[model samples]
Target: MNFKKIMQKSMGFYFNFLSFVNPKKLKKDGFELFCNPFARKVKPHQLEFLQKGISDVLDLEGYQIQTYKWGSGSKHILLVHGWASHSFRWKNYIEHLIKNDFTVYALDAPAHGLSSGKSIHVVLYAKVINAFLELHSEIKSIVSHSIGGFATTYFLDQYKEHTIEKVVIMGAPGEASDFFDFYKETLGLTTKSLNLIIDEFYSQLGKLPSYFSSAKFAESIMVPALIVHDKNDLATNYYYSIRLNKHWKNSELILTEGLGHDLKSKELVKQVTEFVLN
Candidate 1:
């Protein structure tokens, strides 16, 4: 087996062993490991775009969330990238937004990009979104990719009333529970370890993963939104966007093939700009 497979197997064995001796400790350990996302190394080109804007940091809980700003339009737009992704991923999108006379703010979610954190969860991601929203109420729209879309929808639903007028969700997963399944499969968790880890999640979040559904949240949001997904996306299935669109009364759905998860086509940029501007 390769190193990754061997590591997963070892983790499974270790967690199972701990479950027999101290399930609670096993749960704590597993939960911590599960909550943290793997940080990817920043590329030189990514750094170039990240530096194009004025930079600042927002002190959040125990982490420092890095933010970048471009343009000086009074109305602001927020760009939220996905899991293991940093603000620089939206560099091209930011260029398009700026061309439309909109100021843009891109943030490094906790544990991603230059943010200081070991890991991040959807709840914490929402907290970060809310913090920036509170600090910059001028933000009128958001463009989010992958897990970032989930966090943004959660924040909007939980807050109810907000200044946000438009949102674009691209290749976002449908439910939080799906993440647990993927995590369990990735780590090759034992049943005991999985149960313990799930229990710990409930203990901390005060609810089960089933309670956090993007489709459910979308049902209540009246803000105009554009849900874009690629039929061939391997990471997040396009079906999630279909489900979200069903309940989002004011939202539009754009399904594309061949673009895959990173639907960064100039055509998509044009559609997004038109929807948000509309």
Candidate 2:
């Protein structure tokens, strides 16, 4: 077997064994592992690009969130990146927004980029977005990718009072259960271990994993939005966006054939800029 498969099997064996011996420890450690993201080192180009922006840090619930600002236009925009990704992922989008005279803002989500955290969840990310919005109330436009898109939608749903004008959600998952299933499969977790972890998740978040659905959140968001998804995206299925679009009354859905999940292209930047600007 391959190394990754072997490691996954080993981890499954360990967690299953722990479940029989000490279920409590398995719940705590398994849940934490599920939330923790692999650390990504900043590249030289990414660092250089990030250095051009005005930098600030916000202390929210003990996590230090690193934020960046660029441009000085009257219209403001925020860029929210995907899971395991940092603010640097928006380099092209930032340039496009700046060229369009938009005061662009971006943040490295907790546990990603320069932020100070070891683990993250969608609710925590929504709180982080809320904190940033509190500070920059003028920001009325948002462009988000993957989990960032889901968190943005959640923030909008929870905090109804805001100045948000337009939003772009790209390659975002519709259901939180999708992640839990992926985690279970990746680790080859036993049903008992998975159930224990789910219980821990509920104890911490006060909601079952299936309760956190972007489609459900979209139902409450009235802001005009553009939902972009790739038909062949292996990370997040395109059907999620379709389901979300049906619920988001004022949203538009765009399907691309082969852009994949990241959706990084000059054409997409142009389309998103147009959606936000006009």
Candidate 3:
């Protein structure tokens, strides 16, 4: 390589190293930085539309932009957005649910949007679902994404009588234990930093910070699950989908190439409709 190119590369590395070592960056807690473009890592335009829909549905006059909701019905469907995402991310899916005559609810899990709190995990996320289910009834199915997919597995383990009839897991995880490890590697977080994150997470909850592998949940869960994932998704990868199929008692897995992590569309609508009807 040319000397100029080598020097530029060295400077780039130094810049990144300096940023990571900055004390100011480390001292600020999770909530202090409620919405980081880097932390969230993703956003969709549909969020605005969905936020408006939520207000219209509730006939609310104010706007803190509550990104979660309990649809006005016993029989219903649900869509769960991923980590650092607002529930409004499911606008396309919501339209399909309404068109198919399904009352739908979507949750913007803690720290993602209007929901109170900071960064969250599958266990706490599942607890929110459990809390909602206890009050509601006739929940028909779920269409969940990424970490939302992992959280659903936590719920499958907890519910005994199978209140959830069907589930469409889009880019879900197969092994919860592996999730944070992936986060660690992707963000270059040391074991010490990972432990600190877990500690912070614990301070926020009674549940432990582990969403460990529950192949048992898949095997024992009677709900019909459809695992939709992209082969090229750098986030969760495809292993989770394969594992869901392997362990699930009644699941159909579809592996799509070139789609990456965001796999919502007309195809998703059709597949979701078929699963709910069946």
Q: Which candidate is the best by TM-score?
A: 2
Q: Over 4 Å off in model 1, which ranges?
A: none
Summarize candidate 3's per-residue lDDT along 1-278 as a digit string, tens digits: 78866664554344335346752333234213222312252244555565555442221122122334534543488777776676666777776666666777776676656555545656667867765665546676888888788778778887664578888888976664475465455445556555554554455554443545646567768788898899899877797688778888788988888878888567867877788777
Q: Against the true structure, whose lDDT is highest?
A: 2
User: Which digits, one per residue and each the tens of the lDDT, describe model 1 over residues 154-242?
Assistant: 98899865789899999998887887798678777777778888899899999888998998888779998999999999999999999
- Regions of model 3 farther than 4 Å from truth: 1-48, 51-75, 183-211
Q: Over the full model, what C-alpha lDDT does candidate 3 score relative to the true structure?
A: 0.64
> For model 3, which pairs clash?
174-240
Tell me the TM-score of model 2. Answer: 0.98
Output candidate 1 Cα RMSD.
Answer: 1.3
- Whole-model lDDT per candidate: 0.89, 0.92, 0.64
Per-prediction TM-score, please?
Answer: 0.96, 0.98, 0.72
Model 2 clash tally?
0
Order of quality (TM-score): 2, 1, 3
